[model samples]
Target chain A: MSGTVLTRTALGAVGVALGLYGAWLTLSRQTTAQIVSTVQYLVGGVVLNDVLIAAAALVVGVLVTRGLPAVVRAPVVVGAVVLGSTTLLAVPVLLSYGRKPDNLTLLDRDFVGGWWVFAGVVVACVAVAVVVRVRRGAGGSEPA
Target chain B: MTSTLPTQLPGPTPEHFTSRLRSPAVAARVGLWLGLSFGVCFLTGLLSHYAQNTSQPIPFPTSPSWGYRVTQGLHVITGTAAVPLLLVKLWTVYPRLFERPPSLRVRQLLVTGLERVSILALVASSIFMLVSGLTNTASWYVWHFGFRAAHYGVAWVAIGSLLVHIAVKLPVIREALLGDVDDTHSHDRATAVDQGVMSRRALLRTTWLASGTAVVLTAGATVPWLRTVSVFGIRSGDGPQGIPVNRTARAAGLGDDELGDSWRLTVTNGDQSVSLSRADLAGMTQRTETLPIACVEGWSANGDWTGVRMSDVLALVGADPESDVTVSSIQQNGPYYTVNTLQKNFTGDDRTLLALRLNGKELDPDHGYPCRLIAPNRPGVLQTKWLGSIEVQA
Candidate 1:
């Protein structure tokens, strides 16, 4: 059976998280300064997409790989890689939200470096998917 | 030990996932599109910087009045839309980033390593640029002016890496895009998604639509739309320059009108050349306007510019509106900044002129000094400063 759209369960988690974050930012009654601060945080996180742009990629990768045989699920694999990478990026923000801001995240000074490591991982995953697909094709008669 | 059957999914395990950098087609496509868009923004921004800081002029559209505004507005809008496009493009091509270096080859490893590093730089700096830019837009002042410096600095990194990306992947990009839109289509049965959903097609459509939406939203905000859905309303506030922050006036910085130079402007016309000094020119029709000087960065400010009508200057110089007039700068920097007839310059009203004052006072250094060109609804870039010469480009 085609494994398309079969991976919605995990994706649903991310979607829910994104929506919740967005809603919280929207509904919170903040002073102008507080609003500015929140907006700054939001903008800072979002603008990262211009370079690392991992969030949308993760979503698309998930959509692309949602269906496919296990042997060639390039999109789904890509999605997982991007998702994991972005999760690392979200760590600082979550830490900040949790009121336990760890200054060591280096988000302000080396944000691009941090985010790009995730992007780099995604690229690596795509290659792995290809190799696995090819090996599976070569070993057609071997295992059940 | 009674163990349940392993619930491992059939086929390749996650650990065996190969790299995408191996897929030259995907790598090349990602590299090219990303590089081009970044290049366009980088170049335009560089150009604007020069124009803003110096009195030199570039051959910008000068007619229809509102031309400069449209172009600069477009530049900002495009930059904003790039946020989403960059993300989506990276998502699609990110997989190729992981392909192993050419095994057993030193030369290939260096080449591949360089490419990977450049890609990394491009991704890293672009994220910095977008985040900083958006935060600034939102007035999220976490950092100091250092953020501005960082933005410019990262821009160079992004541009350099993007160029490398283009140099390496240009040929592949050309080939892939050579075919019609349908060529990008994939119909392989191995990767089909759900029944009514064509994934690749949907992706492309979504990308284009998102870009178009950005364009529309920006234009709507700038071009005076029947509706208003400007993202965050960056231009929603009012000051002289839409400088929403730093409102407290400085000590001893009396507003402009207090200076009261009643500056005179002189106008002269000769063959292919026109000269104007502050005195003879101001003798002509003097106009005062309180208009916001909107910038491409989505910032706006209201300044009172008092000056003679440029049309009258053109008339004295035998430069007719029927023909294009080239306005040049007095300061030694440049003479190329001139205006031509654009659609917006004709604001169905008479609000366009070369402004000479701000807030009832003579122009300041940070603002344009001596004199500068001003038109309604046009972007700040087109308003050239330091009055020098005007030539009718026949």
Candidate 2:
């Protein structure tokens, strides 16, 4: 066998072994409810990324690129991605805001307002890009 | 796009969704960023694992109060950045999932199967690590399992699968990255090159920007100055002494009476055990150091801690400075109620303290009221809040 193939196969075997060991450890140590939840979250994550996030990116990437002028597409799509991901990361905090019973110190921030401001900033940037693109004409000076 | 070429071999071409954006050129480029991000995260995570490990062959560092803070910070930051990069990388290579083998022979079938399985494992484990890590940083316990153990285990799986993925694709990566990113090559036949609204260069730049934005938005928990801009930042460093508390004494089931005047800190080695009252500890020489209490949950704060030096206390009890000291907590009934072992370096560090005060004021009840073990380059969890006693391990 070639060096690359041998190395790849060996590494692949190691990965599979380690993954199985991790799965076993998680299954063995955790309670049944915990195991169920772990599986649930694992599947949920895959679906979230592959189906929801990837599909959204694809649809938006296609839609904006097809509909909008060449100059504004990149910035608008990039800004939307940043805005969406930041919002996704902020969701848990926003939902559980001010809910810490023992210590209000944790998650005490006004995350809802913070997210709103973040969205406003992203929208403003996109609007600025749109204006610049329209003023500069269809293909004027690619987005920096 | 040419449908047939010398390298195409003798078989029907596999039909699938084709996009110029999903070229090998894009995959190799984005894969580099994704790989680097995961590498940094894994290495830093291992450092964190070693620092928190009970068994120490060589003592972890005791200087650089911000060592754990920076490393654990990078751990979360790199992982967060990978979220966007991973998405782009996967999107660029998603068509490969549906590509069929040219032949049904044993070698071809075996190769295709192995490659597909490895890809699946790599993607699955990466998603698991990123998602679970995000939840952990947010301190949202969506699962009942132990986060540390599962996270550690999955880290190995992710790294291993990543190595396999790299090894298998090194040649393609080398070829694609060797020339201009827009270089049309033999592999271009699989994709219809489209000079669309967004050029190839534009897409790459946007991907990089997205990743950078992700890091900047969430890194405030670690980078102090970015606290204002990091709107999605979990911790704003706004608490007692600009520190955040994970578990309070009341939550740990330790009432005010437990931490009242009767509380005593006991130090023991073999046959020699010394118990000192709160006033007794206060009468001893007090040293102050500004150290950040960095938690594994990813929030940290610098505090002016005043207390008796750990080395002094160990010396007073005639405990060997070269040995390990187990610091026990008053929260003796909970999961975190277990003992935290201090290695020789930590025991000998004069800066290590059984802290009684923070920022010139008594420690808040939530900040480990009576006394808390404070050491350099240690996770807040292992700092052993609500101190009870210290025993020199054999």
Candidate 3:
């Protein structure tokens, strides 16, 4: 084998070993029921992201991009992505899912307002970019 | 069996993914940062796990005072940053899901199979770690198993699979990265065309912005200066003594009688033993130290703790200078973290204190009441609030 192949093979071997050890740790440390639950979450997360989240995102992208003026499309797409992801990250806190009645300090932020403000900022920035692109004239599709 | 089966399935193909932005050039660039973020998170996570282990092969350091703060802050910040990076990466490479193997040969099929398996592991573990970590920081316990153990285990799986992935895609990654971001060339599907919606550079910029925003919104729990804008931060640095309380006295089930005037902090080393009441402890030599109580969940706050040095307490009992001590809480029936080891380095450190006051005032009932252990370079969970007794390890 060439040097590259030799390096790849060595790396692959180490990766396999580490992966197995990790799996073993998960299996041995947790009880049977815990392991089953963990696997469900682990596999479930992938399914949720790929099948549901990614599909929905793609569908939205196609729908939103259709019939939009070229100058505004990029900003809208970028805005949508940033807004969606920030919202997703803020969801747990927004819902106050873990908020304790006694402990006012935990999850005490005004997350809804924060998210809205964030959304506003994103929208404003996207608007500015769109306006700038429009003013710069059409066919401003050059790579950055 | 293979001969009878159809060669193709009725679904989207590589050509179906026609967005010009979804090219290897974009994927490779985003993947570089994503990989770096994961690497930082993994190393820092290892440091955190090692720091919290019950048995220490090597004693955790007690200097810098802000070591754990920086590492854990990085751990959470980098993990949060990975969210957008991972999403963009998946979007860039989603077309590959529809691509077919080069040939039907046994070796080719095996290689493709291995590659797919590694990808599955990487994606699943990455998503799981990020989601679980986010929920954990929010104190949202939706699962039954211990969060730390599962997170740690899956982290190994994630990093391992990630390494394998890099090794398998080395050539493609090198080619994509070495070229310009817009140089799609052979990497893009034939159907991909410039719709002028978004450039590859624009997408990369958006990904970085989203990651930075996520960090800014949540990192206030760790970075004090950004607290105001970090409106989504789990802890708002609001508590009894200008610091956030992880486990309240009420939550820990500590009643008035437990923390009453009659409360005594007992220190014992083998046959030697000494007990001091609240007033008695107050009468002893008091030292004040400003230290940050950093939590594993990534929020931290600095406090001015005034009390007797742990070294002084240990000396009162004539404990061995090199001995480690187990600090127990009054909440004997409480859940995990009720007991934690104070290694010799921490015990011997003059800055480590069994604090009786916070910000020059008496300890709040919720903030460990009469006394709590305040040590530098340690997890807040190990601080052992509502102190009951300390036993010198043999």
Candidate 4:
């Protein structure tokens, strides 16, 4: 076998083995409800990544790159990711998980307003980028 | 031109999405960020695990209360930063998932199968770790299994799979890094166009900027100075005495009405027992020390904790000041209530306090009302609050 293949196989085997053991330890100790919840969340994590997050990035990436001039494309994509990630992080806070009758100080922010303002900044930056790119005729050719 | 035409018999056809920008160079670049982020988080996570482990052969130190603060903060920061990097990394490599494996000798086929399985494991475990980790830091328990145990277990899986992945992709990563990023391979460039969109280099720059922005937006939970600007931070600078409260009195089912003047902190030394009320404990020489309560959730605040030292209290029961003592909470039951044990290092520290006051005011009910343990460099969860009793164990 090739060196790469040999190394891949050996390391892969050990990694997979250790991973399986950990999963077993975690699963065996959990109650049925916990196990089910664990499975659900694990699968949910995959779906959140492959389906929701990746799809959003690809779609928005394609849209900005395909529609905008080259100069604006990079800035807009960066803005989009900045907006997307910050929003994703801010969701739980926006949903107000920190707010409870028992605890007033946990979240204690106008997260909805904070997000809207943040979104506003991202959008404003993107808008300025589009204008600058258009004014400069930055694509160097007719945009495909 | 004829050679460029597709020439393979296909079964269960893979999805074909054409994009010239999704090249190995871009994937490797994003993978570098993903790997670094995960590496930092994993190492710091190990430190956090050791800090919380009650069975430490040597007791954890009770000084520089901000020690766990920095490590755990960096832990969450890098983990949070990885979210965007992971999404982008996966997106860059998504097309590879569809590429059919070339048929080969039986031995080669077996190796390929192992490689594919390892990749699958890596991807699945990484997703699980990032998602569950985020929820945990948010104090959201959407999963029923123990968060620490499961999170810790899956972390090993993620790190192990990461090693396998790096080993498998080392050559490709090396070549990608050595060559100019724009030097796309022939197959990838077949559909390439100079359409004036963002170049691969531009895309990488954007990914980096986005990650930096994410860190800036959320790191206020750790960097006290950044709290006002970090809109995404979980704990705003608004708790009593500017300290963030993880669990409240009401959340723990201990209300003002529940905690009456009749409450007493019972201390037992083998055959001997003593119960002291609030005034009795308060009247004792109140030593004041400033300590930070750093939680596993990645938020910490330093407060001037005023109360009696653990050693002085242990002295009351004629127990060795260096001995470990089990500290119990008044809350009926939960994972963190009655099982915490203060090690010799903690119990021996004159600064370690059964704090009766915070920032000079009488203890707020939410901040463990009557009393709470504030030790140096300990995870806040193990700093048992709502004092009930202490037992010196042999």
List per-model TM-scores for chain B: 0.56, 0.94, 0.97, 0.92
lDDT of 1 by residue, B267-331 (tens): 43445444445556556788887665666555544566787666666666565543344555433
Candidate 2 has an lDDT of 0.79
Q: What is the fnat of candidate 4? A: 0.53
Best candidate, lDDT: 3
Query: How badly does each model clash, as a count of residue pairs?
Result: 58, 0, 0, 0
lDDT of 1 at B331: 38
Docking class of 3: medium
> Which sections of candidate 3 miss by over 4 Å?
B1-7, B194-196
Candidate 3 per-residue lDDT, tens place, B8-118, comes to 657777887888888888899999999999999999999999999889888899988999999999999999989888988998788888777766778978888888999
Writing each residue's lDDT as its tens digit, candidate 2 over A7-35 gives: 76676677667667766766776778877
| Candidate 2 clashes between residue pairs 3 or more apart in a chain or in different chains | none
lDDT of 2 by residue, B1-394 (tens): 2322323655333234445777888889989999999999999998998898888787789878789988888888998899888888887776565566656667877988887877777887788888788877777777766787778877776887788787778778888988678776646654456655565787788788878888887788878998888877778888876678888777789996789998988889888989988888888999999988888767788899999888888888787666688888888576743577888888888889989999999998888878888889998779888889999998
Each prediction's Cα lDDT score? 0.47, 0.79, 0.86, 0.78
CA error at residue B83 for candidate 4, angstroms? 0.7
**What TM-score does structure 3 among the candidates reach?**
0.97
Candidate 4 local lDDT, residue B29: 85
